[model samples]
Target: MTVREIATEAYRESVPVLVLSAVGGLFAGVVLGGWTPETEQVAGLLVLVPALLATRGNVYGSLGGRLGSALHQGLVDPTLSLADERVNAAVAASLANGVLVSMLSAVLAVGLLTALGRPSAPLATLVAIALLAGVVSGLILTVVVVSVVFVGYRRGLNPDTLAGPVVTTTGDVVGVATLLVATRIVLALGGG
Candidate 1:
């Protein structure tokens, strides 16, 4: 293929995905905007938002990339199955990392806020919210990343080109929405 052909192919494959990502981002923003009451009730929750979302994107995005590479190399099949040890391990590792990072982010947020002498919710409350959000979002993102990468690959599209933006956009939307739900659950349980 010539340079023009390569460019055209990349554009053709990536533009629609990018457009979808933009729409997903706008939807995530709408969800966040509607969660003002939760944020207000849980001090320092806003601080956790970026970190949480970024962690999801980074962790799950890497998982997507790895799966893409594996599929390309024929190291794993392009199907979601626990019977495939490689695919199972990749997903397990991503989920563990997601949960650990989520908890760490909450702890760091609380410590930072306390050091700065700013108001923050209790450490336990933040940890609980983080834990809940992390598990739920991690599960959801795992399935999503796997599905998108596999589907794109099967469709003759490059998963490498699809993984990053899709993961980031889905991560943001799912992370924020999960955080809101977790916060509500924790608060109702007499946390924070």
Candidate 2:
């Protein structure tokens, strides 16, 4: 496709994902509301929220962008399989980035809170929750992002436009939900 055609297609494809992202964000807001009590229980969990969300968006959202680029470059086959070396490498990198970045973000959150003399959860607990939640959210996002990219491609849509918005929205919802679960688990183990 020519540049104008590609841009138009991307714009068209972005519409649905943007709509879904808004809807999904609304749900994530509700989940965050419910998280109030849990955050109170583990003070630092509050601090970790933004970092976790950023990690998700940065890692998985970028994964979508990379996949789209690969498809456009024909480095990754148009098929949805990991049979392509490029696809395998990208997936592995995304997964690693998701987990590691989240853990580091947790540490950064703790450090930031400490520097400000704010009360926060211990580094260990924060790290644990971030890692666990990151894994859960990451796994869910990987499948969803990959599927959406392929579906968009098969439907003659640009994956670039759809993947980022969809994955980020999903990351918001799944990331919060998984973080909540991880927090509860931590509380159960150590009384928050």
Candidate 3:
């Protein structure tokens, strides 16, 4: 084959790694943040980072994997260059999945926190707070992932390489920040 063709094939092969790296970075951040030592007063919130990160990764990673399939099947066309109804459907499906996963994560996080003897708030209240934070962060993450993938695709970039890394890293930053902000809000409101 010609050099041009070889270059094209090489670029195509690199897409998947790009996508996975993005998501992996986000997960790594969560794990790192969770494992960080807290001050004596904040020890109870130790699980906040990992739990939130795990949930974010679960929700976003699943969606990313699905999108990867859609891309593989010629179903992803954000620029209207590839007329495929499946792309739109995939976006909708992924959004829904992200929201649902966020809620579930919130519930589990609250339960785990309570079990660990952190009763700053009641279980119900904690769940509500966690769910709200999770959902918000998930929503943001979904939008970011979708937008990044679309832009990358339109620019003739491979989703495999760009999507995963961008989505995962962005999600990690957003997830940690969101958790901290939400926790602070809950504490302030509850006068804890």
Candidate 4:
């Protein structure tokens, strides 16, 4: 593509994602700000935040990559009216990864906190919050990434270019919100 073409396509392809990303950023800031006091009060929860958020991004971002590859290969429909097999498989794998990774991340976070002689939440509480938050956020992000990829493909744009940034941004915002809710629920349940 020529420079002018590239510029035009970039503007066309990226604007929606960028605008949504800005919204996501604002939501993330709110979630962070609101969650900060509790997170500081609980030692292990703060550590879980980064790992939980990263897991959401990694899982959904990879799903986007696979879908983009399939789009390029003429394997995916621009729509999912028939419930595409590849998309189903991708979602299943992503969910499985979300559950497993969230559990592991919680364990790792707790371990690290203990190693550092930091006060820690109960192991079960940390694990529950991480697993619940990660799975919920991952599911939401999967849908968002899939929608972005489908729209990008339908618009004759490369979904690969659009998916990464969008998924990461969505994951960050939704992940934090999900964590906050899960933490509250866990604490209410006497887990914290």
Candidate 4 residue 177 C-alpha distance from true site, Å: 0.4
What's the residue-level lDDT of 8 in candidate 1?
96
TM-score of each: 0.97, 0.91, 0.66, 0.91
| lDDT, candidate 2, at 17 | 74
Better of 2 and 3 by TM-score: 2
Alpha-carbon error at 26 in model 4, in Å? Answer: 3.7
Model 4 residue 112 lDDT score = 90
Q: Stretches of candidate 2 above 4 Å error?
A: 1-9
Task: Summarize candidate 1's per-residue lDDT along 60-107 as a digit string, tens digits.
Answer: 999999999999999987765669999999999999999999999999
lDDT of 4 by residue, 44-101 (tens): 8888888988888888889999989988998878876447888899888988998899
Q: What lDDT, from 0 to 1, does candidate 2 have?
A: 0.85
Any residue pairs clashing in model 2, and if so which? none
How far residue 172's Cα lies from its native spot in candidate 3, in Å, is: 1.0
Predicted candidate 3 versus true structure: per-residue lDDT over 93-190, tens digit per residue: 76676656655655666677667866544454545555666777877887777666667666766665665566667677777667666666766666
* Candidate 4 regions with alpha-carbon error over 4 angstroms: 1-4
Model 2, 1-192: lDDT tens digits are: 899997787777788779989999999989998887888888778777878887888888888898888888877778777577777788889999999988998899889989999998888888888888988888898998888887788788888778888888999999989999988887888844
Model 2 TM-score, 2 decimals:
0.91
